[model samples]
Target chain A: MRGLGTRTVLYQQNVAASLGLYNNDLKSVDILRETGPITAGELSKITGLATGSVTALIDRLEKVGYVRRANDPNDRRRVILVPEYEYKEEVGNTYRPLHQSMHELASSYTDEDLDLITQFIGKASAILEEQIKQLNVKKSKSSS
Target chain B: MRGLGTRTVLYQQNVAASLGLYNNDLKSVDILRETGPITAGELSKITGLATGSVTALIDRLEKVGYVRRANDPNDRRRVILVPEYEYKEEVGNTYRPLHQSMHELASSYTDEDLDLITQFIGKASAILEEQIKQLNVKKSKSSS
Candidate 1:
């Protein structure tokens, strides 16, 4: 449990540091990076953040010039978020050290070991997400 | 780059969501989780956060009862951080989802594909970290 927790924390910190952004700022960047040009409403739903929070996140991101909100061409009522510029180069540069360390670490492992670790991490992540969803549902049900 | 960024963001978000902690809060949690009962100074060095920043972070974690500061048994001048009782359970739940997801995703991939992606990510992360370090060194040199 501690190991998983540590991994999760490092993963976030490393990613955020690499992007030259804080954690909250990274959320918007992440949504745009993954889903691409998503509506604020959709972002709120997908991220499970409050609408107000999403709006504020978008506001901060826009202020930093990392993101822009444009009206969806097909749906004028919807505003879609996009990255101000492609972040590939900047982000790629940020993770170089961790990647190098991982390479060295992996080199010490056999193929089976690497596979087992990867599989373990992946499964663990999915279970965490599912549990979170269940927790959220329980909270909502109790509140209602 | 996109794949790396997305994966990194997801990993962080999943972990944070599990602990019911935010990204910034998770930094301290992660350090404590990894090194176990470390001094604030050690955390600052390991996290690359300013000492002042680490202090504030520790304050927040302490307020939440997630972590505590104890006088070092060997060195009275230093304070060591210890996780509270629930920390393990909290951390354990965080990785459960990720592990499940990895198991499913891995089944779809050939061993070679997994190796390739892992190697690519490893190389890319190293390159990125190196670039950032170089930039930091350049800045420090210029300032001096």
Candidate 2:
């Protein structure tokens, strides 16, 4: 049971550290990872991060050669973000070891067990997010 | 498949944000979460972070009322770190929504499909880690 939590943390830390980025950096990555070539404003909206913060984040990632901004052909005011293909490959390569370890670990568990864990993690994440939202609501109401 | 990755990122972000901590800050919480109370030195070893860094982390956590350090009566030089009881409730309460969601999601997936997805992710994570490790080794060797 405890191994479950540790594995989750290790998985996260290993992925972020391998990419030489912080968790927030990964959040930015996720926005791009899920939807390819999005504008900065779009990413900001999706992530709920400020435009200024997104700019800084994009700057940092660009400096590291992980991402780049291109002028939107249709809209001059908008700049689209495209992950550097080479960078994605680089990041993907870095994840190979962890991926292999996870595969081996999963092999030990039955399909039923794997399904249980997946559903468990998925539901658990949703529950956690809802609770956080509720707490924020409570805090706001209290302050008001 | 993509949804799983997104879910993982969401959980990672929620965990970080709820704790008001970043990647490095959560290292201690991770240690405590996985192994319960542990000696500072042991934590340093497990985390691969410097002892000084661990000590500083402990200090910051102590200042924030998140963790407490206790002297080991048998070993005066050793300090054991424990998470405050409040954190247990906080973590559990925060994760409740996620757990419930996961339970529902599990019910939707066939045991075989869940196994396949879990296996895939597990393999992917291991492969990624291995690739990164090899890259690091190559970099080190080249530099030398």
Candidate 3:
């Protein structure tokens, strides 16, 4: 399982390199795609980056047209980071092969077995998220 | 599955940060652990880093006592990168909690179900590995 995790990471880093983007930058875009428009503070929390670093990350991403900063309508004091759909569409092409392969693999499995796998994964993901939260807490405590 | 993969990468990056090491440095250690003693050139290919960068990466890991450069016994002209046991043990401790939790999770599954998950993961990993190889090839071609 650990070896599988490491390979997954390596594959992601390679994908980022292929698109001429840093891994963290691609990760930020992914976060935005998942969460929709969020404040820079939220991005820092989710990504475990310093607030100032998040600012710089957003700047670089915006310059590359992957993301844009917008004023929060409800709270003008806050800036929201939004992913650019066009860039997402372009990068989505790079992942087509991977998705296609995974889809084929999934189809080979019985629906009942797929459900079991999905349930297992979802629970495992929850466990990992909890652990990640704990790690982030430790990180912030030490840094301060 | 993609989300799980991203979380796995994020968790690893956070672990590296908490240990006062960069993600790439930790990844180098992981590669060394898996490949046994490999050459710097092989590390570069595996990591998609430039040869010069690989040299610096090895130097950093060496300074931190996580890796050592030794003369290859079979080929005196080449050097091999070896992972230090002590550091692996220390790093292994950091992953202990995660491993424990995963073990517990596995214990809940029946043998047949566990076998299915393992089989699915093995096939999925192979697919990802193939795609990664193609991406690396593209990256090298463009860079060259």
| Number of the top lDDT candidate | 3
Say which candidate scores most in TM-score: 3
- Residues A67-140, candidate 1: write the lDDT tens digits: 89899898998778987645567665655665666677677777976676566556545555565466556445
- Write down the lDDT that model 2 would get: 0.64
Question: Candidate 3 on B1-144: residue-level lDDT in tens?
Answer: 867777778788888887789888888888788889999999988777789989998898899899999999999999999889345665877777788888899999999999999898888888987888888888778879
Ranking by DockQ: 3, 2, 1
CA lDDT of each prediction against the hidden true structure = 0.63, 0.64, 0.85
List candidate 1 stretches off by more than 4 Å: A1-20, A87-144, B1-20, B85-144
Q: Is candidate 2 or candidate 3 better by lDDT?
A: 3
- TM-scores (chain A) of the candidates: 0.71, 0.64, 0.92
Q: Which portions of model 3 miss their true places by more than 4 Å?
A: A85-87, B85-89
Indicate the residue-level lDDT of B4 in model 1. Answer: 36
TM-score of 1: 0.65
TM-score of each: 0.65, 0.69, 0.94
- Relative to the real complex, the DockQ score for model 3 comes to 0.72
Tens digits of per-residue lDDT, candidate 1, B1-144, equal 333344444455545655567766675675566567888887775555667988888888888788999999999988799977345675666555556665667667778766765664455444544543554454346558
Worst 10 residues of 1 chain B by lDDT: B1-10
Off by over 4 Å in 2: A1-6, A74-76, A85-89, A102-144, B1-6, B85-90, B103-144
